[model samples]
Target chain A: MAQGQHHIIPIRMLAIVFGLLLFLTLATVITAQIDLGLVNVPLALAIAGSKAILVALVFMALKYDNKVNLLVLVLGVVFAVVFLALTLADTELRGTIGITEPGTTELTVEPAESE
Target chain B: MSSTGTTLKHYFVNHEQQFDAAKLGMWLFLVTEILLFSGMFVAYAVYRSWHPEVFAQASELLDWRLGALNTVVLLASSFTVALSIHFVQKGENDKVVVLLLMTLLCAAIFMVVKYFEYSGKFAHGVFPGAGFEPQGIIDGKDYSKYDIPFAPQFFSIYFVMTGIHGVHVLVGMGVFVWLVTRVARGHFSPQWYTPVELTGLYWHLVDIIWIFLFPLLYLI
Candidate 1:
C-alpha cells in the first residue's frame, strides 16, 4: 500500500453530520417563518454556512486530506466573500458616495450654457 | 512503484502523486464552480436588498416544504457518495456500486421533484422576465396577489439559479451512472479510486451550493 492509500471515514461520523445538517435545515425553516426583523437574512445565512462547513469537513473529507487541498478550498471561499462584499458595497451604497461637488456641477453647467 | 502500477500513468511518479495532482485539479475546478455561482448570488443579494418586501412576498409563492424535501434528498445523496468513497477505500466494490446507485437514485428524485415545482409555477404563468404573470391559485393562495413591481426580478433570479443547479444535478446523474458501471467492472480499488473520489468531491460541492440556495431562495 502507498503512503496515502486509504483514509476510510467512519460511517458513524458521517451519519452524525448528516443528522446535524437535517436538524439545521429544519431550524432555518422555522426561523424564516418568524419575522426576525433585519436579522432574518443573516440568521439563515449563518445556519447555511455552518452546514456547508460540516459537509466540506466531514463528508468531503477535507479534515483528513492534504493541507494544500484545504488551503485551496479556503482561498476559493475567501475570494467568494470578497466578491460578495465588494459588490454589495457598491450596490448598497449607490447614492451615498456624494462624488459630485456642489459648486463644480454649477460651474461646468454655466460654461456649457455660455458656449 | 505503487501496488497498482497499471492504474498509475507513465507521467506520474507514483499513485500518490497522481492522486494529489488529480485532487488538486478537482479543487481548482470546484473554485471555478464557486465563482460561477457567486455571480448569481450577488445578483440575488443586490435585487433582494432593493426590494426586500417584494422578494419576501415573491418567495412565498415557492413551497418551502418542497424545497426542504429536495434539500434532505440532496443531503442524503451526498452522504451516500461519501460512503461509497469509504467503501472504495476498503476494497468493497459491491458496496461501492450499491452506494453509487443509491446516490444516482437520489439525484433522480431531486430532479423529479424540481420538475413538479417548475411545472406548478409555469402553470400559473410564473415565469422569468416579462413572461411573469402570477395567475391561478397555488396552495389556496391567490397568485394574482403576488404581481407586484420587481416581482419578476425575484422570479427571474429564482428560475435562473435553480435552473442552473438543476442542470448540475442532471450532469451528476450521468456521472454516477458511468461510475457505477466502472465499479461493477472492477476498475477501482484501494490503490486506484481517483475517479470515484473526484466525482464524490464534485457531488458534495453540488450539495453544498444547494445548502445556501435553499435558504436564500426559498426561506429568507
Candidate 2:
C-alpha cells in the first residue's frame, strides 16, 4: 500500500484499551455516589479523558492523520469545550451577595457594661 | 472517467490522488460532525452549570457498567473495522469478513447492553421523558431527593446523540454487509479498494462521535 498509511489497531490492543475504558467509566460512576465535592469533577474528567484518547488514537487512527489534520481536530474540540467554560465563567463571576444558607441568621446583641 | 486511461479511471487520476482526496473529504465531513455535536455539548455545559446538582443526580441514575461496556465495545469495533479496512487493502477477503463480522458482533453487544440498561431503567421509572421519578421510598421521610426537572433533559440529549450513533452503527453494518457481498463476488481487487477505505472512514467517524459522547454525556 501507500507509505505512512494508517496503522490498523490490533484486536488485542483494542480489547485491552476497551477493557480499561469500561473499567474507568464504571469506577467513575460508582465514585459519583460518594460526596467528594470538587474531587468529583476531576475524577469524571480523568475517566472521560482516558476514553477520549483511546478512541482518538486507537479507533480513529488519529495517529495516522498528518500533523495538520490532528491540529484541526484537536483545536476544534478545545475551542468548543472552552466555549462552554467561558459561559460557566459568567455565572462564577457573580458574587454570592444575597445568596446565603437557609439557617444562617445574624444576631445583634446589646453591648455589655464590662468594666 | 478520470484524466487517466479508461481502466485506471476506476480509482483516481493516479493512486496518489485516489487516497488523499478521499481522506481529505472524510476529515472535513468529520469536522462538521464534530461541530454539530459541539452544539449539544454547549447545551449540556449550560444545563450542567445551571443545575450541577440535578445533572449529577440524574447522571447517578445511569448504570455505569453498561456505559462502560458500550465504550469498550465501540473501541473494539473500531479496531475490527480498521482491521477490516487493512485486510481489504491487502486483498485478504477472508480476513476482512472475519474482522467485519467481529465488528458487527461488537455492535450487537452494545445494543444488547443498551437494551438491558434502558429496560431496567424503565422498570424503575427512570426513562427519558415523564416516566422518571427520583424517590425510591428510602426511610419513608418523603425525602426531597434533590430531584431536578432539567436533568432528564440531558438524557434526551444523551439518547439523541447515542441514538443517532446507534443508527450509524447499523448503517456501518449495512456497509460491511455490502462489502461482504461484493467481496464474495470477487468484485474487489488489490489494486482498487476505495469502498473499503471509504467505509473505514465512515466507521472511524462513528467511533469519533462516541469518543466525544462517552465523555460529554457519561463522565460529567
Candidate 3:
C-alpha cells in the first residue's frame, strides 16, 4: 500500500480478533458467575474494555488509519474518563462533613413493601 | 456494474483527501455519540455505587444468558461488517454483498432477542419509571420480592440504556440494508468505498457500547 492509501487488513487478522472477542465474552460471563468479591466488577469492566478497544482498533481500522483519527478517539475517551471521574468524585464525596468519615452513603429511598 | 466507483468531490484535492476528510467527520460524529452514551454511563455508575445491593439484586432479574447471546451476535455482526469492508477494498462486490447481508441478519437476530427480553420483563410487570411494578414469580425467583426502593432506578436505567441501544441496532440494520442495495448496484469499489467504511465504524461503535452494557447491566 502507498503512504496515504488505505491499509487492507488481512482476513486472518480479522478472524483472529473475532475469536479473541468471543473468548473474552465467554471469559467475562464465566468470571462473573464466579464469586470474586470486589474483583468481579473491575474484572468484568476490564474485559469489556478490552473488547471495545479491540473492536475500535482492528474492526474500525483505527490501527491503520490516520493518526489524527486516533487522536480524536483518544481525546474523546480521555474526556469521557474525565467526565466520569469528575462526576463520581462529587457524587461520592457529597454531604461528607468530617475528614475521618468516608462517604459511603446510600440513597435513603425507603424500601417498598413487597406486593 | 463493477466498473462504477465513487467520483471525487470538487472540494477535496484527491481521493485520499476526500476519504480522510469523510472519515474524520465520521469520527467526530462518533465522539458525539460517545459523549451521548457517557451521560447514561455516569448515571449507571452513580446509581450503582449508591445502591450496590439494590443494583445487584435488580440485575438478577436480567438473564445473563440472553445478554451473552446478544453480545456474541453483535460481535459476529461487527466481524461481518469488517469482512465486508475487506472485500469491498478488494473489489469483491459479491462477497461484500453477502457479508453485509450476514451483518443485517445478525442485527435482526439481536433485535429479536432484545424484543423477547423486553417483552418478558413487561410480562412480569417489570416496567421502568412510574409503571414500576413486579408481580408473581418465575423459576422461584419472586419478581414481587424485588420491588424495593432504588430497584426502579435499576430497571429504569436498564430500559433506557438498552432501549436506546436497541434503537441504534435498528438504525444500523436500516443502514446495512441501504448499503446492501448499494453494494448490489456496485456503488462501492477498491478505488472508493467510504460509505461502507463509515457504516462499519458506526456498527463497530454500537457493538463497543454493547460490550460495556452487557457486563455492567447483565453481569452486574
Candidate 4:
C-alpha cells in the first residue's frame, strides 16, 4: 500500500493481538484475586493499560496507519493523564494547604490559676 | 459525488487522501470520547481515594464473576468486529456479514447479563442516588452491611459509568445492524470500506473502556 493509504492488516496479526488481550484480561482477574497490598491496584491498572495499548495499536490499525493519527491518540492520552494527575494533586492535598485557622493548631494556654 | 461509488470527493485529490481525512476525523472524535470518560474516571479515583475502606467494602457487593464474564464477552465482540474489517478488506462480504452478526450477538449477550446484574441489585434495594439502600442477604453476604457511609458513591458511579457504557453498546448494535444490511447490499468492498473500518475502530474503543471499567469497578 502507498504511504498514508488504506493498508490492510494481516488477519494473523489481529488474531495474535486478540489472544494477547484475552490473556491479559485473565491475568488482571487472577491478580486481583490475589491480595498484593498496594501492588494490586497498580498491577491491575498496568495490565489494563497494556490491553488498551494493544487494542489501539493493532486492532485499531494505528501501527500501520498514518503517524498523524497516532500523534492524535498520544496527545489525547497525555492530556487525560494531565487531567487525572492535576485533579488528584488537588484532592489529595486538600486539608494541608492555604486554609488553617491560627488557633486551631493548639488550645488556649490556660492561664496558670492563682490563689 | 462521482458516478463510481468508490470515487473520491472533489475536495480531496485522490481516494487515499479522502480516506485518510475521514479516518483522521474519526480519531479526533474518539479523542473527545476519551476525555468524556476521563471525567468519570477522575470522579472514581477521587472518591475511591477518599473512602478506600468504604469502596473496598462496597465493591464486594458487585459480583466480580459477572464483571469478568462481561469483560470476556466484550473482548470477543471486539475481536469479531476486527475480523469483520479483515474480511471486508478482502472483499469477502458474506464472511463480513457473518462476523458482524457474531459481534451483534455478543453485544446482546453482554446487555442481557447487565440486565440481570442491575435487576439483582435493584431487588436488593441497592440503587444509585437518593434511593441508596441495601437490604436482605444473598449468597450468604449480607447486603445490609454495605449500607455504610459513602457506599452510595460507589454504586452511583457504578450505575452511571456502566449505564452509559451500556448505552454505547446498544448504539453499537444498532450501527452494526445497519452495516449488516448495507454489507448484504454490497456497499463495502476492498477498495472502499471506510465505514466498516471506522465503525470497527469505534467498537474497539467501547471495548477498551470496558476493559478499564471491569478492573476499576468490579475488581476493586
What is each candidate's DockQ, to 2 decimals? 0.67, 0.24, 0.48, 0.50
What's the lDDT for residue B127 in model 3?
A: 96
lDDT by residue for model 1 (A1-115), tens: 6533567899999999999999999999999999989999999999999999999999989999898999999998899899999999998887735445545443333335454
Would you estimate the TM-scores of all the predictions? 0.92, 0.74, 0.92, 0.93
B124-160: candidate 1 lDDT, tens digit per residue: 9999999999898867899999988999999999999
In order, the Cα lDDT scores of the candidates are 0.91, 0.67, 0.91, 0.90
RMSD of 1: 3.4
Shift in Å, residue B94, candidate 3: 0.6
Off by over 4 Å in 1: A96-115, B1-5
Worst 10-residue lDDT window, candidate 4 chain B: B1-10
Clashing residue pairs for model 3: none
Model 4 TM-score, 2 decimals: 0.93
Candidate 2 per-residue lDDT, tens place, B12-32, comes to 766656566666677677777
Q: Point out the worst 10-residue segment of candidate 2 chain B by lDDT.
A: B1-10
Candidate fnat values, all: 0.77, 0.33, 0.73, 0.67
Q: Give the per-residue Cα lDDT of candidate 2 at B95.
A: 84
- The deviation in Å at residue A65 for candidate 2 is 3.7
lDDT tens digits, residue span A1-115, model 4? 2222356688899889989988998899899989999999899999999999999998998888889999999999999999999999999987645446455545434555696
Q: Once model 2 is optimally superposed onto the true structure by TM-score, how far is the C-alpha of residue A28 displaced, in angstroms?
A: 5.0
Can you give the lDDT of residue B21 in candidate 4?
91
Model 3 residue B121 lDDT score? 95
What tens-digit string does per-residue lDDT give for candidate 3 at B1-220? 4333356678878778878888999999999999999999999999999999999999999999999999999999999999998888888999999999999999999999999999999999999999989988987899999999999999999999999999999999999999899889877778878889899999999999999999999996
Better of 1 and 4 by DockQ: 1
